[model samples]
Target: MKLSHIKLYPLAIPLIEPIKMSGETITHANTLLVYLKTNTGKEAWGETSAAPLMTGETLGGLLQNAKYLGEHLRGLDITELNSISMVLGKILYGNTSVKSCFEMAIIDLFAQAQDTSVWQILRDLSKNKTQTKPIPLPLLRMLGGSLDKEVADAALYRAQGYRHWKIKVGSLPLAEDLERVSILCDLLAGDIVSADANGAFNLDQAVIFCTAEKTRQLSFVEQAIAAKSTIDDFSLLKSKSHLPIALDESIHDVNEIKYFDQANALDGASLKLIKTGGLVSGLAAALELQRRNLKINLACKVAETSLSAAATASLGFAIDSIPWGFSMSNQYLEFDICAKPLHAENGHLNIEQLNPIGIGVTPEINLVTQAHSKEYSTVLC
Candidate 1:
């Protein structure tokens, strides 16, 4: 069936509690949700969340791009996802977040049309070895603002059955960062705690923090230095620190993977679908990383709704290769605008089952209506 209509909803959902990262405090999540309707009357959902600081795409820009994408998508065959992705990629240079949003919606719709989950679709597409058992999904915990807050946050997540936590670092003074790490270790005991620097640190600073005698409990350090830092610098940092490093911004595409390989820059990499464009590219990156025997951390954007979450869940199941971010399941802490809450049990999220002919869930009509009304009045989209 061909796509008949598409709609975009730009939303700002306030967080119940503020989430503080290195350079900013996030009190509300700003995101765009995309809806696609087929000629056969099937509907699918998708989400794209852009942090102006991260991707440099504002809400207005995202919405405009969504409109442009929607126009191109209209009249396209729903099942030809790869062709659609290629055509869109040729038109849009680096707005993978926008492209991914549309691609995901189409995939969701395709799966629903078949009355199956995205995982089943992916399993059928795989040429590699497939495991028979379901992989256990991991809980994602964020590192809080201060040393005391980090400890408290870890304890809070642990109480809720989370054993893995990711702490934010790099923005703090070296001494202060170590102090927080110490506190986190004490609170978490034997639990896993990874540190995300968010590309805030320099190579020397990252080396010092990773090698510091007081910081020994870290599972890995993520994007400790800016993406511009040379792979050689990462190699030097890796040599000096006991902790392994995971590349985030550093490995954006296949070419970058070769660069990292040549430089021996990291022990692992974090793959986000938006960064790589969609599930297809993200999976390709993961498989390549696996071929190199490097660890992988599958991550999601903060503003993702259930549509993107379902696709991410499929990735988690298909890989089962590593523990990664799946924090949307705990939206009570993060703030979610989706009508239905994502379900999590014992720190694990069961994959959302997509209806065989379209995206399983529909957009929250009231929220979308209100957003569109505001856009009409404000000329936002």
Candidate 2:
């Protein structure tokens, strides 16, 4: 079907309560919603949030890129998403968020046209490759920061039946970070814990932190150093730590996965749909990681909404090869803007049977009036 029009909606969803991470407290989230319409009367939806601190792309930049993409997308065939991505990639230097938003919209469109769920499409693609069965998706508990409040927050999450927790570390002094982890480990003794440094530590520091007794409490460590830095440092640190390491910012696209594989830089990789540009690319990266016997973690930025969360859930179930970080259960502590809530039950999230195809979300425009827009979008592509 021919693409007809594209529309963008900018919305800000307030956090139920402020979330503290790496010394910063977040009060609200800003997300951009993209709508794609086809001549066949099929429509699909996609969502993305701007995170400048991590990715270096802002909301304004995302909007500009979306507008440019919309222009190029007009009248084109909907089935040519991969080709479109290649063409767009050549023109735009880097804007994974933009590409991701559009790519998901395309997927949604395709799924709607085929009258099937996204997961079904993914299953068909993977049927011949692996013997593993699709594992149930789990609700991700995010341990905000290494503060007193963070400890309290983690305890509350444990009380709520969350089995897995992703802790934000690396911003603290090594001693303090270790102390916090020790406290958390003691508090949530049986829970699975993971640590994310957000690229704040170098090789030496990562080694020291990972080798520390406190880190032994974690299932894995994430992005200890910046992705732009050489993987040699990661390899060296990984060799010494002897603990599982998951690279986040390090693997930007499917092609870049080979570099990490060659360096043997990490034990697992955090594949964000936005970071890989969409489900297709994200799946390609996950499959490549699987080929090397590496694990995968589906993660998201803080600014995502239920629409984005649902899209993530679809992808999570599609690739049963790894654990996923659908942190929406933790982030949506406040009321959700979507008509249907993406809540977790017994630390697990189940995908709904097809109803509203493609992202399966409809934003409540009335609630947008209550949203705060003071925060400017950061570039976190």
Candidate 3:
């Protein structure tokens, strides 16, 4: 089948609660959705969120690039995903978030054409080359607000069976951060705790922070130093610290993996489809990290709809090495845009919901119809 039509939907859904991280707060889902239609009447959906601070991608840029990509995609054979990906790489350099939207759309369409899930597609392509099975995904919830508020939230999540927690530091003084973490750990004994600085600390501060009394109690430390911090700095911190150091924003490509491997710098790496440009590339990076014995964390964009959540869950189901847990932000959305929403039960996401065709969940027709004013569609010549 050949490419026949393309539609773009720009959605800005309000979050149920504002997400506080990296010294900022996010209150809405700034994502652009794409619907790809083939000549044979097969169609699939894809989405991308704007993270200007992380990936240097904006909603405006993603929308423009997606429209431009649609122009180039006209009449192209739908089955040649590699060809499409290669051409996409040539179409723009460093607009990875934008590139991810088209990549997801093509892969979603391809999987739909095959009457299979995207997880199955990646499982077959994995290095193991074996049929993959769905597995339970343990989730990590972020801790925010005042110390008392954080404890309250943690208590609620703990009751929900969430055992892993991530507390953001670097925004507060080291001593206060330590005190908060210590209290939380005392409140929830035996559960895993991680500290994410969101690249807020300097090299010296990172080392000092990790070596502190309560900081050492964490399961791991994420991006203690800034994203632009050198491998040398990370190596130095890793050498001095007892806890494993994970790089989130620091990881952008597979080549960075080699850098970390050569220096023995990081103990973990976080993977997100939007950051890696899509599931195909994200999985490749994840497998390589696994081969190197580094911990992997599957994360979803903040305020993403169920469509992206379903895609993330599908990937989580196939990959068993992601022991660091997933950062699923579906709970932050006020009203999801999918017909069937993805929810976590007792910290474990149900695998059955991720078994649908293509990327799993379908967009709610009523919501899509209501958002038509935000949509731009064209029939490719």
* Highest-scoring model, TM-score: 3
**Lowest lDDT block of 10, candidate 1:** 372-381
Q: Give all candidates' CA lDDT scores.
A: 0.71, 0.70, 0.79
TM-score against native, each model: 0.90, 0.89, 0.94
Model 3, 14-78: lDDT tens digits are 78778788667888788888887889888878888888778877777778887887787777775
Which is the leading candidate under lDDT?
Answer: 3
Candidate 2, run of 10 with poorest lDDT: 372-381
lDDT for 262 in candidate 3 is 87
List the lowest-lDDT window of 10 residues for candidate 3. Answer: 372-381
Model 2 over residues 1-381: C-alpha lDDT tens digits?
A: 677877776656777666665535666676677777788788777777777766666677677787777777778774553465675576566788888887777777776777776665665565534445446577678776336877788778667777788877876687888887878877777666788888888778888888888778787888888776876787787788856888887787767778777787788888777688777777778778878888777776775766677677676777664553555532553665666666666676666522445555656655543442444331212
Task: Indicate whether candidate 1 or candidate 2 has the larger lDDT.
Answer: 1
Q: For candidate 3, what is the lDDT?
A: 0.79
Candidate 1 vs candidate 2, TM-score winner: 1
lDDT-wise, the better of 2 and 3 is 3
TM-score for predicted model 2 compared with the true structure: 0.89
- Which residue segments of model 2 deviate by more than 4 Å? 23-25, 80-84, 87-93, 128-134, 145-147, 353-356, 368-381
Off by over 4 Å in 1: 128-133, 324-335, 352-361, 367-381
